[model samples]
Target: MGSIDKYIFKTTLASFALVLVSLTGVIWITQALRGIDLMTSQGQTILTFLGITGLVIPALVLIIAPIALMIAISHTLNKLATDSEIIVMNAAGFSPIRLFRPFFLATCVVAALVAFIGAYLAPDGMRRIKQWDAEITADVLTNILQPGRFAQLDQNLTIRIRERLPGGVLGGVFVDDRRDPQERVTIIADHGTVQKTDRGSYLVLYDGNLQRFEVGKRDPALVAFARYAFDMSKFSQGRDVTLGIRERYLWELMWPDEEDKTYQQLSGQFFAELHDRFMAPIYPFAFAALTFAFLGAPRTTRQSRNFSIGGSVFAVFGLRMVGFACSVMAVKTPLAALVQYLMLFGGIGVGVWMIVGGVVVEPPPRLMEAINRNNERIARLFRRPATA
Candidate 1:
């Protein structure tokens, strides 16, 4: 609320925004590339590919928001230290806790955004991605409509055509089915066409010979037919959206459909997901506080705190990894979820205490300082001329 708070708040927020957009954009492009085959190989347009890929941004943002907050807070503090602004503030009788106000506020803001994304935006985006993928998969014929090439429709079906004739006529058609364990089927037809109805789609072959061969006995039995209908249902079966945990909304994770046996079996995953979503928002504040406690406090000397910064990063990263492990462990034991809270809030409390307490939270631990000094000495020794 004060001038100092507002200044730090603006700087932190700006840094976070820049980092968020830049990181999200870089990562999103890599992920979106995975879907490029939809446009290149499949019949999808550029807009369709972009639309489906763009839906992924919300999920990426949820992952990046906390990290951006950490970087932003650290950057602003380091910049202020470099400019001697932090020293001026300390000279002006401002405490570390007072200086932490704006950074804390900024962290809280990012945390809330993460919570919202996890609850609604991320889940909704995931659902959209699923639906889009399913739609693309179900339309198998449309996706694999290339003429004069063999197209593998499913695990055991392959079809090739000499050409696609006008008026939906397929010329020089060859279809093979090997899905059955006991027998293999091959159908050769001079002409064929696909029929899609409300009930299901069918591939009708005219003037074709159907060959069936037993797996153990290879002598084939052949039957000639004027007309035969092959079901396409297997290629385009509808997927049950409820089966996917990421597709389910937050409420569904908390209170799932009771009658579903799969949900009962996967109860641990559901609880884990619920706890993770709720806990993601809390990380920003904890990480921000801890980082500031390590790197934000003022010192009379203008010496670099690179070691302190590295230690802070590793410490925070280790904590984040621990939280990740806790989420996995919580799936098996519900009590593990409590460990996340203890670690997060405990780190927060310690960080704040370091800031407000009169005694110094050393810029770098003595061990870390000693390691750096030793490393520098080794590097200088290695660089010196060996035999002058």
Candidate 2:
């Protein structure tokens, strides 16, 4: 790599990093907000909330990196053109291929990053999310300890508290249990506390009475007691965690087990996810090439690069949208997945042709020019100062 390659590569990488971070931060904020109740309503700490929600980031970056790379390329190329750096490079006899090399190397880096995220980080993050959810569900103290609301431990058992005071005291306790076929049990107490141990969690009722009713008779039996303990072990039952196609590793996705409960009855999604992981990493390279095709050629005019930028964006978006559609169809037909490969190659082949042929694909300038003239006219009318 020459000094120019290092410079362009460094500049593009810095811009790419900035764009990726900004876009990912905006998206992560939106997604994190949806899970804010994990702290507000679930008695969870802020760290817990952030950590749980942060697990989705790798998957999100997998989707955002390609778009960011494309934008960074357009930005860098446009800046170079506007400053006449591209013209100087062209006059100095720098071929398009040489100028394109640094960006292509950057594209390779982004592609590798995408592949790692899609194959490993994303799946590992998903697994963490699944594990976190499972842990939270089994945590009675954190998940079901909300004050002044009825939380059902099971279909037959529910517990409520009027107030969860400071120092771990519970006031106005109510318990309803109907697991027994022969009777229903209702317990109310003035004060109670929820305690956990190795054995299990238990609701200790003080100065309370249990009212048990016979299933078929109206008469009920009241048993007065100084203290009673209701076993709440059932609430913390550990459920078996099942890994889905999204959580599976790359090799697992390639050779999924039909008998695996996680993938059972999800054949369409299985194949689709496998192909998507493979296809996702290719988009970064294709998008970068497409940008080079649009803006790599030298231009003498200082025209706005908006048209070129928009055209590149549209092209990339169209290709990706088609790839996604094919992925969906591939679920059922399997053969439709080949369209993704075609889309990848077609983008690169067309981009190479345009770059070699000195083609600059830009949006229609006439439409934008007309809109700009109308805006100028409106501004002039508003600034006439006749009213003064």
Candidate 3:
């Protein structure tokens, strides 16, 4: 790279990093707040809360990187224009395509990062999140009951205690379980403690009475025991590590197991996700090219670039929305995925043509005149006479 190219590359990359981190951090905090219950109610530490919540960062970056790249390219181009550097370069025989080299390299870097996150990092993060969430739920069920409150451990199970005693003993324990439609079991114990063995978790109740009620009969079977072990492992088991379409790895999406139940039921989703992953890396390049084509020209101070900038942003947004629509429709019709590819490549082609042909993107003179007239009328309405 030349010295000029290196300067533009460094500036654009620095801007990209700053924008990416700022935007990702803001969004991550909003998402992480949703998991605050882990620390507030589940007896988990702050570090655990952040760790589980932070796993979502890879997924967020998969969406934010392309937008950040576009913003960085726009900023670099605007700065060059503001400093009249673009004009100087143009006078020195530099073409728009020549000036676009640094931005292209930066966009490529961001695109690769997005591709990596989408293919591997995002799926792995989602898998870890599911595993850790299941484990934490188990721990919460076993150890984190609040005193003097009724806790619904599951849809059909409710547990309550009068007070929590030291040494992990629970006082005034009551458990109502209706998981089996054919029967209901209620246990009232004076005191109990949770125990975990190699097999599973159990609630060891002392001085408790168990009442079993069958659905057909009104009368209940009651038994009093000095010590009883109630199995608590059923609630915590079988909830770990299930992969959805979004959680599947790249190769898994490409060559999914034909016999897998999820693949059978959600085959359409698999098709959509596979195409989305393949197409995600193409967006950054399209965005960079469009931005340069719209705002890369040398202009005098009197010429406003606002319309061009707005046009570029609108085009980028429209293209992305089309891609999203195509991805959605691709779930049912596999051919819909081809639309996004066509749009992206077409955008690149148009941008390149405009850049190479030195076409200046501007609003029509009539439209600008109408806008100026409307602005003047609004300004006149807001203006007041000054005191003499």
Candidate 4:
């Protein structure tokens, strides 16, 4: 690569990195806010809250990288034009293909990043999210024991505490077990804590009494005890982590087990996910080409570039939206997947042709005139009345 190419490549890559981080951070904050219960109501630590929320980042980047790349390409191209660098390069016989090399290289890097995240990292994060969430919920339900609320740990089991004390002690503990239909057992304790043994989890209560009522007997029996261990193993049972189609790794999607229940039920979704991963990497390249085709042509300062910039943004997002629609439909109609490929490659092919042909894309003169008229009216609204 020439010096100029290296400069453009570095500039675009840096801009992409900045935009990706800013966008991801903003969106992640929004998602993380929804999980604030992990720390507030769930009795979890801040680290635990952040860890669970951070798991969604890989998936976010997989969706955001192509858009960021487009923004970065547009920024770089506009910067060059603003400084008259593109005009100079054009006058010096620098073909659009030569100018495009650096942008393509930057896009290649972003595309590879997207591919890796989609194929492995994103799904891995999702799997970990499920596992961590299950473990946290079980821990909270069985161990943490929320205060002042009757927590339904199981369909037939409920527990509550008046207050949580330091050193993992629960005060004024209440346990109601109705798992046995033939009898009902209620236990009241002054203090208690959940303990795990080799056998399983147990709620060990201090200074408690248990009252039991059998199905055949009308009278209830009360047993007083200094200490007792109530088996909580049933309430703390681990949930089966069932991942959705978006949570499956690329290999899992590509070679899905026919006998797998999810695969059997959502076979079309499996197909869509597989093709979506395959197409993820291609979007960055197509977006870069399209942005370049719209704005890379040299133009004098007298000519406006806003229309071209808007056109590129619209084209990039429109194509992506179509691809998304195709993905959704592809879940039912397998052939719908082909439309994305056509749109993607068609954009790339046309973009490359326009770039090489030095096509200066602009809106129709009548449209520009109407836009100018609207702009003048809006500007008049904002303008200050001549210093009265």
C-alpha lDDT score of every prediction, in listed order:
0.84, 0.85, 0.88, 0.90
Model 1 misplaced stretches (Cα beyond 4 Å): 143-147, 150-239, 358-388
Candidate with maximal lDDT: 4
RMSD of 4: 5.1
Candidate 1 per-residue lDDT over residues 265-364, each given as its tens digit: 8889888989988888988988898889889878656565876688679878988999989999999999989999899999899888888884344554
- Write candidate 2's Cα lDDT for 105-154 as tens digits: 99999999999999999999999999988877776755676778898877
What shift in Å separates residue 135 of candidate 1 from its native position after superposition?
Answer: 1.1
Worst 10 residues of 3 by lDDT: 135-144
Model 4 weakest lDDT span, ten residues long: 136-145
- TM-score: the better of candidates 1 and 3: 3
Off by over 4 Å in 2: 140-146, 150-158, 162-198, 202-231, 362-388
- Candidate 3 C-alpha lDDT tens digits along 1-388: 9999999999999999999999999999999999877765554667788899999999999888888888998999899999999999999999988988888888888889889999999999998888888776656453547877888988999999877654456789999999999999999999987777889888889998999999889899999999999888775554546778888999999999999999999999999999899988999999999989999988876789999999999989899999999999999998898888899999999999999999999899999899999999999978967879
Model 4 error, position 282 (Å): 0.6
The residue pairs found clashing in candidate 3 are none
Clashes (candidate 1): 0
Better of 1 and 4 by TM-score: 4
Candidate 3 is scored at a TM of 0.80
**What TM-score should be assigned to candidate 1?**
0.75
Highest TM-score model number: 4
TM-scores, one per candidate:
0.75, 0.79, 0.80, 0.82
